[model samples]
Target chain A: MKRAVFKNNWVAALMVAPQLLIIFVFFYWPTSQAMYWAFTLEQPWGGGNTWVGFDNFAAILFDDLYWYSVQVSVVYAIGATVLSVGMALILAVFVDRQLRGFKAYKIGMIWPYAIAAPAVGLAFRFIFNPGAGIMLYLNDAFPGAWDPNGNGTHAMIMVIVAGAWKQIAYNFIFFLAGLQSIPRSLLEAGAMDGARVLRRMRDIQLPLLAPTFFFVLVINITDSFTDSFGIVDTMTGGGPARATNLMVYKIFNDGFQGLDYSGAAAQSIILMFLVVALTVVQFRYIERKVHYT
Target chain B: MIERTPILNIVTHLILLSGLILMIFPMYLVLVAASLDLKDVSAIPPKMFPGDQLWVNMGVAWEKAKFGEKFLNTFIVAFGVVVGKIVLACITAFGIVFFDHRLRMPIFWAVFITLMLPLEVRIVPTYAVAANALQPFQVFMDVTGLTWAINAVTGIEVALEWNLLNSYTGLIMPLVATATGTFLYRQFFLTIPDELVEAAKMDGAGPVRFLREILVPLSVTNIAALATIMFVYSWNQYLWPLLVITDQSYGMVAVELGRLVPKITSTGGEVAKWNIAMAGTLIVMVPPILVVIFMQRWFVRGLINTDK
Candidate 1:
């Protein structure tokens, strides 16, 4: 790892200063303030903040609502990761075999990736609109069958669908790449041994694609936390009786809207810790698998 | 290519086409809704065909929802972020790759830590900082003893209380702390091969000259790639602008699209304008969609390389 060193130190300092400054002022300072507020009792109304260590943590952990949010977030993460990644793997497998018009699918698939989360949520909202949507077509045979707006389970499912729908493109890209990188001779050997397509997938392909699977899983999970804010904010607004209030939504609802600064900051810290741990693992795996195969 | 499985190929086509339908269905619905007026959109099963009101609904969304201003604001914020973050990232990557500075590792890790502490995590404190950007400036002034000197010499004391809230700077500034661009640029720069650097140095090219003459031209594709991704990322931003921009006049199209969602009014007083909401959604998606479509190669390459 030989790096060329610039002779002038001033030039070097000047070069990195802008980005470092942005991060310091925006990223690090706010993070430090969040860390400070996490332990202390910083109420919304009162100006003076009393230092009450661990009380915030205890309160948030003990609260039934917070636990419920945790359960909700976990379910969302797992559901979204599975749906998006599973579907992507399936599509990648089909496309990897060089189906006709696979290039068109490859290009068409990425449109969803570029679509904003809010747009995704909005689009799904109309699709799942209770009265006038295609869902109404289902209710025609059976009166009052489905309504994501009023039903908790339905709302949660819609959020998951919207979240996963946006992510399928991303997961598909990596899976397609990973599947392509597997030596074709291995598949030929599997086929020559009389292994069917499904058998070949399970025995030969899936094992080799583990790294990409793991990578996408972690990414989709972490993305579910931070990225779902848009989908939640738009689709349900964490709503129909707080049905879709994932942990990240709780932070925004409690802190920004509810003005519970201390509690929200505590929630933020908790989410941050989880993501930080995930990101460390993410960085390690990615650095090792630079080509992401 | 490996084995002939006739039934499997047909089944594969069926599944892929089905997946593609799911992907396209929503956009198709949105487009259908956007084209139709209220009555057609509210009709059972909604309108399947494009209506005559596509332009009309867009105009309504633009005029009634003040979408023009929102579009301008979104453009400013997204464009600024792309320009600001990409340039900063390139220089930061250049500094890290080309210099053995003492602070390089610390700076690199600090930027890397931004990856974990995403903007959503510390929204409250970050909002406060955006609302009161002067605190740090004043502290710097005090630490440098400039405040006292200015006060002593000018007989006037100034306390800077400039809030970046609702401004383009407010929108663009905080968001630029992303490490993805830096990481992408750094990875690209690292692949430049030490031989190129050594040869350039032997030819008596200074650091700036070498970077401009060789590295800059070489990294144009990387820069464009990163810019495409960053632009789309910035344009799609929903929460940050929601927090930072409290002023209604500075509304972003993403947030406005959410608002444009006509509420299903209780007591059935007036049906929600599903048409306008769909139109706004279409408008909000168009720029990013166009960008990603036009720069598909670069966009995909940047995303895979950045991997975050």
Candidate 2:
């Protein structure tokens, strides 16, 4: 709230109504409906429903395919977070050295952030196509080496790489900002003390960047869980033996394709809790980060 | 500037160059593939160099994918979302920050809680809601027995439904309902000095006047930044449009690109023509990438400041 403010109730109400109405119709209504369907057995296409407390959850929890989706989702979240964050940190450190044409590198690195994940997926699909590109040479060297379509592990790696490719730009921006925010005097002191570049980064810069690292970690994890839908949908529609059927993709598949309303609703509830928990952790870290700074 | 070791300098440039290459490699492949003809594109080890078929492939992709209409729909949705989000967020933040009403906190929290619940989490139910935009009103009437009373008096049962599916309203409203822009505006508004508001009050400027003459001008950069982000975000939307829009004519570019890649072929085989798909991807990518490169300053500021 501002210290100096207006006191017009009607104007205020009118001003806030549009946003409140929009959120109610879109956010709250749908969220409440999801909770309703999660606890009730409902048919798709506006059919009748019956209340079945916790039965939907029970069925989903017992289903092996649901467990597989959860397993792959965790693997994807972890894999993407690690790959993107690590690559971004490396690139950010190198760029922060103020090498020649650093500005161009920064600009080049950040443009991928603008590219849609689905587009990235499509591009990488071409690059990794077994019949073409680098994969062809590798397959030529060894008769049957790389086929994401036939192999599940290879599919997972492909999606993770594609997912991480876009995120590297995002994490690079933050990591670069974090690196720059560290007082240059600290690095200069380390340099005067004859500490090598890598040693100085490990000792001083990395420690100070813990907050940024944690922030990017939480963001990347949640994003991989939810946002990987695009990449997975474009690249491997959660195919090749249910390998990349991440939770979000599965929800869409089961709800829209399979028409298992209550089951998908229950799964959605579970994923929602996971996201909410991660977000809470993130917000809590942000609060602590404020004081740390 | 910290250390001028020749070995470290060479290594730093080498490492940065490699990172840049890794970043640009996929895009380079897309470029090369988009520029090649079908035969050249599908060759073993693929054509790593650009060919003269760029315009030809783009023309083919454009015609096959119906990108002209798709691009138009995408522009409407993207532009609508940006304008709608900015307007709603601007007014909402203005109300929350400049007023002393009791509903202020409630409304603020209402928007705040939505930050945690992204569209992906409750996608199915959202589709349900969007399919019938007037269901809430119907439910309200039924729960209050208004429908029953009306039926008993007039002998006519009432049911209301406004199908938002396959419409522009359905696409833009849900995407614009997030609180990111509101929070961004609020963060910015708080940084504004109290003295300015006092001066405006002394000048007899009303809340609307103060907002128009004072805050909007000051927040131009912030608005531009948020618009850049929101435009890219909405333009890149895939799942929502895929679910809400059943008609091919209403498809968005991202979803269309996704659709084009899987089963698109002149001969209708399992393998899609990589060249045309790459061309389509490049065409779809041009707008957002250009926005990012041209508005680099605002885009970065929006990303960093919104997170903070």
Candidate 3:
């Protein structure tokens, strides 16, 4: 019995060795290096780094540009999240009613999410091109119509609209799946209680779909705040003189473009804290509202 | 049943129809613009109808972008990444689940923590590693005088002259290990009952045989879903490729499309060819859109199950 147990343990260890090696090299080591580099002011050309404890963090916190970026990111995240999730809920409810050719619409709706962000940004840029863009044409037809690149506000709005357009489909697909999983008998029970359709949706459906809503909210926020540099990089390049700059785009610019590794790492560490705090708040406060079933 | 009313139904349909139209109009514009002539493309309000310059514009874009070679490069890189990820993720997940040991828990935690560490955080270090540390083994290279062994093993000649900087290896190698794929497969393998594995072991099926015959066959749905997701992701990846690949002729479609936009000058007075850029955008978005439309059922199913 003892020999068998020892042999099984040895086999298990042998099998697990490869996976552990990959995780250590790819995930753990790189992350640790990033954290370490945040404190050292290393030069780009072989110059040794000086230890500037808390200076990098303090610079980011005190800078006006950093504050502006954080504000813009929050606004974009909230706007995109609300717009996408609201539209998704409405679309899912409509599709759930068994419309003809629902599958085609379902497929079409989810198509945008699969397209690469840079490609989507490029497509939208063309669609809104100043001379030939349909939106430009429509704006020209009306008096005092604003150009997308005319000002910071217009540019910010355009980015948010584009982000929301790409994200709604993702939210819709998930909500549709969540709606499908809810047992019909409960809905039938609500109906039998003389609950109006609106009441049924408000009282039963909304509460039941809370978990999916929470999940979508988290994902949308993460994508908008953290992963949108690709789109911004391709579309505006944080441009028109930094009008559309967000937190992630700022980090990319500071680190990779400006070659300020310590500054970028400091910015990244700040962003990391923001993400963790938000996630913790969500779990502590909003998790209570989720109906897991 | 009597509670049902047409008023609510009409309202719902109207909303859905408008949203769907909004979603599709950009793609439609791309198709229309791609087919238009340069003269027609620059016209006021831009012509919505297809023009006679479809082949001409395609030729111009192809020549300007050196698109054929770029497309081939992207295909090789994307396919290689997809295959590598699938094999690596499957083997890793299998090793984690089937080979239960004390080390498994810590390894699992390490993978889980990666979810919080965004790629942006690790880009600088990862770039350094790719550039300086990792190099192809030269023991099997073709040049004999260079102190590198030149030999063909299994009818395959290993080549080292190909610098990864502007090639397919640069595009694919950095993306081999995906945290999302690993997590997906791990969650999926958990659903398989232990009894099946026990039975396979009783029949003298080793780890390799059990994975080949039993685990892989039963996990087709999960694998298909993951493959579709990874393929689309690999094809559409932009940021990393943009940073690493400097040569225009070897970059992906997204990079090519981005170069279409000219840098804005102080005057902002140039008459840009909006039609051509729109056309290019259309071409770039087609493959992933088609993939999603055809394989949406599996994609949606995958997203729903991912949290589990």
TM-score for candidate 1, please give it. Answer: 0.93
What interface-residue Cα RMSD does candidate 1 give after superposition?
1.9
Q: Model 1 off-target regions past 4 Å?
A: A43-47, A185-199, A287-293, B137-158, B262-270
Which ten residues in a row are the worst by lDDT in model 3 chain B? B133-142
On residues B1-308, what C-alpha lDDT tens digit does candidate 1 reach at each position?
66678998899889889988978988998999899978777677556889899999988888877988888888888889998977898889998889887788888887877877678878888898898877777877988999999999997786888788989898998889879888998988888878888899999988889878898889888888888888888898899988887788998878887777653222345656888888888888998888888888877878887875
The alpha-carbon lDDT assigned to residue B16 of candidate 1 equals 85
Give lDDT for model 3. Answer: 0.71
The DockQ values of the predictions, listed in order, are: 0.66, 0.71, 0.38
Which window of ten consecutive residues has the lowest lDDT sum in model 2 chain B? B261-270
* iRMS values for every prediction: 1.9, 1.9, 3.6
Residue pairs in clash, model 3 = none
Task: Report the Cα lDDT for candidate 2.
Answer: 0.90
lDDT digits (tens) for residues A90-202 of candidate 1: 88888887878988888778777788888888888888887765777777768778977788899999999999999999999889888888998889899899998889889
The TM-scores, chain A only, for the candidates as listed are 0.91, 0.95, 0.89
What lDDT does the true structure give each of the candidates?
0.84, 0.90, 0.71
What tens digits encode model 2's per-residue C-alpha lDDT throughout A1-293? 33888978799889999999999999998998999999998655666788999999999999999999999999999999999999999999889988889899999899988888889988888888887777888898897889888799998999889998889999999999989999999898998998988899899999888888899999999899889888888888897788888999999999999988888999999999999999999988888878877
Provide the clashing-pair count of each candidate structure.
0, 0, 0
